[model samples]
Target: DAAHTAMWERLDLDIEAHDALLAVLGKFYGDIYLAQEGRLKGAEYLDFVLSEVHGLRIKELQDAKAAGKKIVGTFCVFVPEELTLAAGAVQVGLCAGAKAGTELAETLVPRNTCDLIKSFIGFKLARICPYTESCDLIVGETTCDGKKKAYEAFGEHVPMHVMEVPQCKAPCDRTLFRAELVRYKEALEQLTGQTITAEALAEATKVVNAKRRALQRLAALRAAEPAPISGRDALLVNQISFYDDPVRFTAKINELCDEIEARITKGQGVAPAKTPRLLLAGCPMAVPNWKLPYLIESSGAVIVGEESCIGARNTRDCTDETPGNLDAMLDALCDRYMKIDCACFTPNTERLDNIAAMARDLKADGVIHYGLLFCQPYAHEAMKVGKAMDAAGIPYLSIETDYGMEDAGQLKTRVEAFVETL
Candidate 1:
């Protein structure tokens, strides 16, 4: 702990504020995660990773830096981890899940900005996120107007690169994305001073695809009647996947899935066989953003699947490794990423179809659409999702809230009532 404190000091973190942030995080994790019963034994790995998310992981990044490896931090799924690896850099997801320096963030962005945008700015202004401090370059993307404009301010605080993500799936869009991939590859090359070769890119694609396959295995296991594992645990695994070493994280997840399969065979689960099963859809729940999931599980329901970017959208499609040359590999990367059904895209009907399909596949009794307060894209899609669910005869509830707990009791009441309907 002393070493970590000294390390944070070296990174110029706000000692008192960061300490307070960790304290709250620890207590929140204890109440939300540690209090669960009949948790899978494999979840111990999740615990260890989260416990050291800022400590050991940050130290590892620092060590990699010492060894001449650059660290690239990204906020969106559009950034290719494969390229980051091929360029000889460590890729990590930056912190943007809690309200740490809202006042400071508001001074830069608007008061009406999405909590996620504000949270990232707050983390940087508060000097509380070691991952942000550890990055050599923080890549931003133009998925929405809010984030695009916010990048103008965020870039002032950190070395930032903005990637243009097309809003529609089209032939020209594919070409645009492919060129953006080249632009990103160039950025990584400049940052790391390493040429991304075809061989290195191919190897990196395999490493990333293996991680996705492991997650896919875990998702399939949740389809078992009683849910062999809890949604909170599964969500944590997904969140940690963004921060952990890709290969080690993949192995650990596969091991966890094996245990889950064994538990399913034994008919053991975190909840009873007939517990109301629910599917969570809509806005991504980043680290420390467990409020809605906690409310759903605590309200006599078990979440079987998450149809958000942080969950299924991220792991649904892996980069095509068939492309051998660097140019073809970039095209494969573009094609795979373009399949994502993020609400930022125009006519994102794929998302509506994907949500209904995931609900049916997981045997979910209902679907709850979560939209963060002030997130226009997801908020707009929520109405469309509700109507589609209505036509399909699946029960649905929509919730919009922020990172603060002031509305927790109110949200729990609505969630409990919705669960009762099933």
Candidate 2:
């Protein structure tokens, strides 16, 4: 804790300094803060933010490299970090800029494609993620058909390399998956000749999971009253978690938790909604591009609750045993994040009913069914939920989304009208 506090002091941050620091950091973009923070603790802290921040930082590294700098571009996920560092290239993540987000993904693939796609598709179509340009190379893993398809389609535009995932399910595939990770490591050696020592992997693990622990703690503070954070504040915390040093972030969260707890004790939280509070259920990413929470919060509504795989579940169960090793830690975190993976595959009314019950518990005024366009599973189930909510006398509204969809003026009018109805 002393180590973390020293770093925060240099940053001139207190626990509540998150609000102020974000006010400053939001003005610029990159991972320098995270790298510096990592050094405050160790490699493990650095590796944690790497999952999301590397892409944002690559621009700095790549720009320097392009101008006669010896920056090697190691494909983010698939390429081994050791190999990339060895190649004299930066270990840039494929989904980096694509992950922490780029722009408002309000269109392109109909909103029904699940939010993560909306993020990539929106960024690619809009051309915001510098990775779309900065990346000298890209790699793909045939993990989920959905992600594979999106990457395959987008890869054609870049120097994309594809790795075949031997299997999708676990047990048989996990070994293969680990092998694939090793194979990916070898491919990096062939392409860049960087040696990925077990030590490096272990180092990466520690840094990355520290970031995970920080993120989890940040999520936990939301459980505080008068919510220790706003949706916008939450975004700031996430930025620090992804880009700043993980150890620093953990310290910050420890401080933030105190500040938030104070606020809760004082009966302060996110501002009360003028509009009837609504609990959003189903896939809400709007493509990782759109800040749906911010949008909703700014719109005078509170996402007092959700059924997102990441929102409640992933952020809550963040107790990883492997404190440092990036690989094992990431696998564990990934599995944890993926567990609540919403089965919007087809809404089970049983689950739907449970969601309604959750909303009731949260004292939500209504339910907003924001399913993406063409999201057959959610679309059908949404219609059912809409009907059920009406019967239960819970005011509800269903909004369909697509990337590059029609008039925002019209959408805004509809949203305004919904608020009025509530």
Candidate 3:
């Protein structure tokens, strides 16, 4: 209780605001997750992560602090978690995806900014997020223009480190990113007061790669006919993967995958047989931004996969564990991070190819390319994705919305019509 109290005080959290935020989460979970049928058994573990998102992770951080460790919070998937782990620190995801605190964020940033960025700004400004508060150093990435500038505002209240993410996969570009990675490694070492040795880097690589393998296993099960797990549940697992402890998260996911395997064997599913399968592409759906997936699933369709950072795009790949030294490990990280086909890239043909491959592999009936309002990179790619899908003879729908429920009914109608066409 003292540790908890200290964390609360350290974060300068507004008790009432924090409680109100949790109340919203409770209602959303009850309405969406509790209403699902025959949910996976291991889903409760992830639910626990949400229910105690800050508490449990903060407890881990406190223990790590007692053992002389530091915690790093990151927003983008580009931040090398392995580096943090190697330097004896924890890397927790701090992206705020909920609708809460938007009013507070708007006071700092313009109303027209993307909701994801605004939500995070709000969470920090409102002091309602323990994970954000628990961070010793907040690592931001230059994935897009908005976030690069927004981090300046965010850094006013919290210590910040911004990674210069390269938009193109040119050899020179990767070299730049590799240098950033090296800089990040040095920063982590200095923060944690721990020198990152070759063994430590190799071990961290193994740990992260194992986590990826577990997620990949779970993903493979989703491809089964009838979908052994709901897309909403699968998405929750992916979202939690960012916050949960790596080893524990991997074990729980593998356990869930085992249950899903049994479900596949028994021909059990959350959706009815022959439900229209969907491939959701574009835009990372952070925690509590479950509107589109919930609407799609409840409207007689099953999401088989996603092409976003929160989905297979982040988990499907693994870091090379063969790096025997620090420099080699950084090179591996650079290679792995560069492989991510973010929309920020100049010629992101890999993303389109990934979408088609996901659609074909998962037997998706249609592709719903969802983007958040004001997220220009993904929004701009919507037309290109539509044209590619059209040429490939795949049904596609592009929907852009903010983090508000006002568009729920309209989105449901559009998604339902898309499923019908499928």
Question: Pick by TM-score: which candidate is best?
Answer: 1
Give the per-residue lDDT digits (tens) of candidate 3, residues 1-422.
56665777776888778878878889999899988878887888977887777677778777787787788998889998888898889888886788767888888788889999999999888888888877889999998988998998888889998989988999999999999998898888778889999898888888998889998888777788888888899889889889888999999998988888888999998888899999999999998789899999988899988788898888878998876767887888999999999999999988888888889988888899999999999999999999999999999999999888998999999999888888
**Ranking of all candidate structures by their TM-score, best first:** 1, 3, 2
Tens digits of per-residue lDDT, candidate 2, 307-345, equal 543344334343344545556644653444333334432
Off by over 4 Å in 1: none
RMSD of 3: 1.4
Point out where model 3 deviates above 4 Å.
Answer: 1-7
Name the TM-score of candidate 1. 0.99
User: What pairs collide in candidate 1?
Assistant: none
TM-score of each: 0.99, 0.57, 0.97
What tens digits encode model 1's per-residue C-alpha lDDT throughout 304-335? 99998789999999999897798899889988
TM-score, prediction 3: 0.97
Ranked by lDDT, the better of candidates 1 and 3 is 1
By summed lDDT, the worst window of 10 consecutive residues in model 1 runs over 91-100
Go through the candidates in order and give the clash count of each. 0, 35, 0
Ranked by lDDT from best down, the candidates are: 1, 3, 2
